[model samples]
Target chain A: MSEKTLTYEQINDELLGMLERPHPSYFLLLLGFLLALGLFVLSLAIQIDVGIGYSGISHPIGWGVYITNFVFWIGIGHAGTLISAVFYLTRAPWRTAIYRGAEAMTVFAVMTAGLFPLLHTGRPWLAYWLIPYPNQRMLWVNFKSPLVWDVFAVSTYLTVSVLFFMIGLIPDIAIMRDDAILKGKKLKALIFTPLSFFWRGTNHQWLHYMRAYLIYAAIATPLVFSVHSIVSWDFAMATLPGWHTTIFAPYFVAGAIFSGLAMVMTVLIPMRVVFGLEKYITDHVVQSVCRVILFTSIIVGYAYFSEFFIGWYSGDVFERSIFYFRPFGAMKEWTLLGDQSIGFPQVAFFLMVFCNVIAPIPLWRWKIRNNIMAVWIICGLINVGMWFERFNIVGSSLQRDFLPSAWGSYWPTIIEFGITVGSFGFFFTLFTLFSKSLPAMAIMEMKESAHPPMRKETHG
Target chain B: MGKFSGVWASFEYLDETTEAIEKIRKQGKQPQVLSPCPRHEIDHALGEPQTRLPFISLIFGGLGCLTGYSFPAWTASDWVLPVSGKPIVAIPPFTIIGFELTILFTAIFTLAGMIGLIVIDTFRNPLPKGAKKYPRFQRDRFGVVVSCEPSQTKEFEELLKAHGAEEVHVENS
Candidate 1:
């Protein structure tokens, strides 16, 4: 697809115009999300005040919905890193249009994911004990535990992601600073000037800026892969049949990029529409992302197949039992037929297989992949599928263990469901605000690649 | 402000900007190139030396990786609190921490290098004592500031104007 030719002034006017006067729909969407955030906070307050038991975790199914949500949100954060760092390193041109929004999603998704472990701990206040700080109690966090590794992985991911996002923003902030001055927005100018570091775009500044950006991009690629891999270890290190697998690392990472790509679609599609950015965010870009989704989906599908094959081939009855029962076990009489079912909840398993494995198949068609509406619906389904994938992994294994006497079904209570819904609200709330205030697209990057006016051919 | 005076010339295109910088340099004056984003051609034209940020980031990241791995290993040895029948200092899992710290410090060092370069080069004055600002320079336009004694300002402005600058402004300190 040919690139849309836009001038520097036109790029600035269109992109920065969104920041200057956000559409009413932006506020309306933000308000709706804020309400969801309110519910999330209230639910979290209840969970803290009452107990972790409010989430409906019991007996053998101790690690229930919260952990599933934690893994899901963390997975959602991965695509951002891949797009911003990996794509930049690889020098994919389309990334310039969509990466800023993806980066924001990464930051907020990590923020949302961080909360779940704290909520799951049932003791949010003592969350600091996870840190390897020198306390007077003469106790250091277990350096050997994957959980401790998780704390470092996640915190470091947040720090690096935020810094990368901010470094990328400096030049844009300088443009915004100038716009603020031109418009006589004193307060905004005041905020942006210092943040811009008086960026005059000197050759010296560019030399350092380019080098720093490249290094951040290089560090971020491995950092992204390692973070999700470490998260997978949080379960892989455990002895449960479904959880104890060597494939979890690559599987989780692939699934993360898959779902993360879907999420990027989920965000950028509506964003492009509401902001009238079809010219910049073109169908060609959507098609490229769809192809990526198709690729990662196959990887995730392979991982799913490998896990079951390994389980059965290992000749371990316990592993075989979990694998067989997870999808085929009949629902017990006392249990509901829905996700809350005690006896081998098959719906989530099949839905996960359907959403994650089957849903992305349509993307193979060039026509459907380019169709924005079709891609959007498929991506939305993939998000649901990935979430259920986590649920099936966490719930199916934990529901029925080795001994029947130790077996138990798990379901989320009202508070648990509220928190889950609120988490979405939380993610979208920050993202909505970000889309309004910051340049959702990288203006400088667009300008860099923008076709300059025909240069005068000099004759020697 | 140390009797600093300069002519800020804004150009709508990179070619004109580079030409203006060259013309200023031919007059034996150093011109500060400014734009909305980095232009490699302009850097080449100005003959600006490459930055040392990559080297600094490599050093910091390598040290960070070493520190991340060794600190935990040393602590494990001193305390001897092994969990889950693993070794006192596990190499496999600790590698995750090492990897994370490496990236973290590389990013921190890279940012520090960028900001430090900016501060030393640009923000040395109490109140904009260095080069002048052309508003378009921060948006779509390219700018070059040829700072000299107050007497040289008119000559610099005329030189920049001759090289196809759209607008030329002067600042005196």
Candidate 2:
């Protein structure tokens, strides 16, 4: 058979046809964003009224849902850089189709992550005081404090993620600009052209860009790990019997990536189905990601069990007493987390294992790989498990600690709960908008991904 | 064919390009590889070149370490001393800031170096001008440009095409 030649017109026509239909996912995203924005406003308004004191977090539990959400969002930001920069350097073949979105997710998640720290502030205006520069008051930020570290870690993470994401987007933006179908899209793309700094699509340019992208990705991945672990360490180092553990760094990082992967799956599965991109996002990709989820889930499970095992074995009375009473031992004096006086949070620990750990095991089977229904079920469970891990870490640890006098209780207030949900809305909203404006996959990378038996018409 | 000297090879991203130069001695033709992204591999690419990015930036990161750790300490102890008596500039204290700046600059330097070293200006591949006339590259096409002599152009292109290159275009600069 002769090779079939496809003209640029044919490719554009194929792509344009896909874009022509109104993506239902876009509407879902819009609705979600609006509601989330509404929740953000409502939560802020309530915090103003109740005076940061209105909700469940108080005293020992001073960090409740806000901190958890902060951590959760930060974790969500991790996968993107991992996908883009890390894999780029490693030269993993599968990264081509997904890295673009992952980087975008990193930027937006960082932005979203920033908002929580801003919202949690008693005097949001005073946050500028944390800046490392000398001010009119000549104030220096607190170096010994986890809060200060968070400010630095989070900001650094945000800044680098944003810079790296922008650099990578430059080439793609140019491609989108030239597409006739983008309509005013080309104008929009040109608006960014100057910022792209004269990207003319030369071989040398690709060489430089690829190098920068890889180097940044490599550096950024480890930073994200350290940043989140530092955030977790904020509590771990606090002498709170339950919080102090060396494993907190890797454990928190594992949880972060575990949740991050789940969040990606949640967004991706729907996006794949909704965008009708079943062709581009094959079952193989889903299977590969599930493997990551499974891997992280196991790490999280080990962290969970290790915390219990070590605490019991350490013979530190405070650690032993707190571990016994709060969740595992079912001591009423210490059992503080949920409807279960023995505390449901321990149950959450198990469920986190179930959804993130045990649940995806079925994915290892070839049959389940093709079973969209089973994948969706597992995806939902993963989202639940990741969220529960946050709850268990933030809530369970705070329920009982070094001193009964210092211990306080927590539950998400209606506003806090709504805002947390809203964050997801905004996350989806931004993703949907980005998907429409840009190539869902990295076209250049995909084209360059050389495989054996190269010939025209081989692609599906 | 391009000439080479000694034990030269280029495979991994981080392997310096100078390693390629070493391999030149064993071959009839000089060889080069296209890594997915820029890396320390370029040092090898540049010929056993030792770049001072680490020594220079280590100084910066250590300075960052000083400021990130000490800034908080100075503020707490000397300036807005807290009721809590938290130790100022604790070593464990500045890890994130130390880490952040260390990373931040490392990334910034890496990105800047990439731009400076690679000089990625214009793109050589795209849909192409007559793309409305051709679309094969988009579907699935990987083109590797092997720098070689005029006599060996046909030979190498044939080899690469057999190795899954769909099309080969050779031009003399």
Candidate 3:
């Protein structure tokens, strides 16, 4: 653990330099992602052209890969608000270095998640019907359904997250504006000067700026908890045995924060490596993030336990079947994720438990927690685990429902898998571009935190 | 009329800038302090007024909540679409919309308030002629721009230099 202190000029020069001259690898990485993005778009087009029938979704398992991907992406989005808003409100200083990336992740994750519902809706053309508006049809959106609640929840989450991300950037942009003028980057100066809002660091402007920032943080805090809870209700509101559970809300919220924190590390580790931001990002920040991951992992572990315990204790047949079948039931015939006839996906269940619950156990040791490689590996595992968690939740539950006759298994078609991979490509593409454009680290806030003002007596 | 001349002095440290602002205030001249970052001490020393952003956000949030609840309630009642035999204006489910809207509106109001305040302040007292663009103030330096008559320029410059100014320049209007 090196405690390397950085100066304002050093920080400015190192971070802003990325924007000035990108590394060769940057273009190569982006080109690869662009290819993936093109492939993803192609898959989406094919799905649309061929219709929803191209998907593995069938009766009783209508929500397959699309819904799972939706939940997974939305879960990944959680850590952003948690890091930027919740940690700030709680007075955590370490968040200053890593929050910019996490916040950007949240925005992009939501953007990616926003697409799934439309994709899931076979008639993408009529997706606007989800919005409540007056038209010749006079048909209004149903406000009572949890699905309707989801439309409101996800959209509001996206809007607020974007605003928070941009608001946090104004001071940094002002810095860029000034730096541009000094460096004689005419084009950058022309673009950033106006966007800087002519900020002169006046007393009045600072006063309003600080107040507005605090209020935004205050409002965004609850949203960190609410948006995911509503997403959970999309399942909990249903009458299905595995879906309808009182524990679903908190359970889903905890899992969301858990997965989101892991994603932050996943994004930041490579980021720090490429950008050479180790001095600013530091081992201490990684340790802090890992500690949060450990805490959330414990909560998720508890939720997993409580869910099964309740299922067994309630003695409900349907609940018991879903629970028992999740971890134990091996099948001579089963549906693989890609719709292939397979032996059993019972492995996914145990893998989910191992990744989510057991993998984080190493983080309990300070030595392992501080080790970047170890943290990175564990965080990556958590990402995989959380995805499996969603898969098990959506797939296992639908695999064996109340009526054995209505029960069936689901495997994502090639299109589903391709679209899933493409979503990551989309996320990374936006993030890579974002890394170069704005101050990836909030320069102004970092400066404020690192070097606060020192008062001096008046000289008369 | 070019009657007033502005002397802008750059300080390497915040302490020097704060001291300069206080000295200028004692001399009955309001000096503007610019730095790369915002400081609470500077705001306190200048007696900056509190922002109305919190209040505005609250008002908008309340209105949004009301609209969130009323629009759904009204539409449900008007359309008479009872879901699962539950009341058209089901209070339990309506809270979700209300909660979401509250967050949405607060964010909207807060953003609007911030931009409005900055723009209004910028328009009311546009930056001093040459004071409009100083890049160093956003670097590791602080600036104090004093507005005074042309005759006071030499005095202000001497005052700043004596106190400790790395560089001093003047812009006359």
Q: Residue A167 lDDT in model 1?
A: 88
The sequence of per-residue lDDT tens digits that candidate 2 reaches over residues A313-412 is: 9989888876665556346554454333544567766777677778877877878867777877887787787777777777777777766666555667
Model 3 DockQ class:
medium
lDDT tens digits by residue: candidate 2, B1-173: 12321111112112222333333323354343333222333334434433333443455556665665555555666765545665544566566666777787766666666555444221212222222122222232222334555776666555544443334455553
lDDT of 1 by residue, B51-118 (tens): 77788898999988997898788878878875678788888867877888898888888898778876
For each of the candidates, what fraction of the native contacts does it recover?
Answer: 0.67, 0.32, 0.76
- Over A1-460, each residue of candidate 3 has an lDDT whose tens digit, in order, gives 2322455676677777767778788899999999889878999999999999999999988888798889999999999999998999999888988889899999999999999999999989889999999989677888988999999999999999999998888878888988989989889888997887767776667778888888888888999898889999998988888889989888898999999999999989988888777877888899999888888899999989999999999999778767877877623243332333332347678888999999999999999987888899999999999998988888877777777667777778899999999988998899989988888888887777755434452441
Query: Chain A TM-score per candidate?
Result: 0.95, 0.88, 0.94
Clashing pairs in 1: none
Q: Rate the local accuracy (lDDT) of all candidates.
A: 0.84, 0.63, 0.84
lDDT: the better of candidates 2 and 3: 3
CAPRI band for model 1: medium
Stretches of model 1 off by over 4 angstroms after superposition? A1-4, A330-344, A453-460, B1-3, B26-28, B82-85, B123-133, B149-155
**Candidates' RMSD to native:** 3.1, 8.1, 3.4
Q: What residue runs in model 3 are displaced by over 4 Å at the alpha carbon?
A: A1-5, A330-345, A452-460, B1-5, B148-155
Q: Count the backbone clashes (under 3 Å) in each candidate.
A: 0, 32, 2
DockQ scores of the candidates:
0.65, 0.18, 0.65
Error of 2 at B75 (Å): 6.4
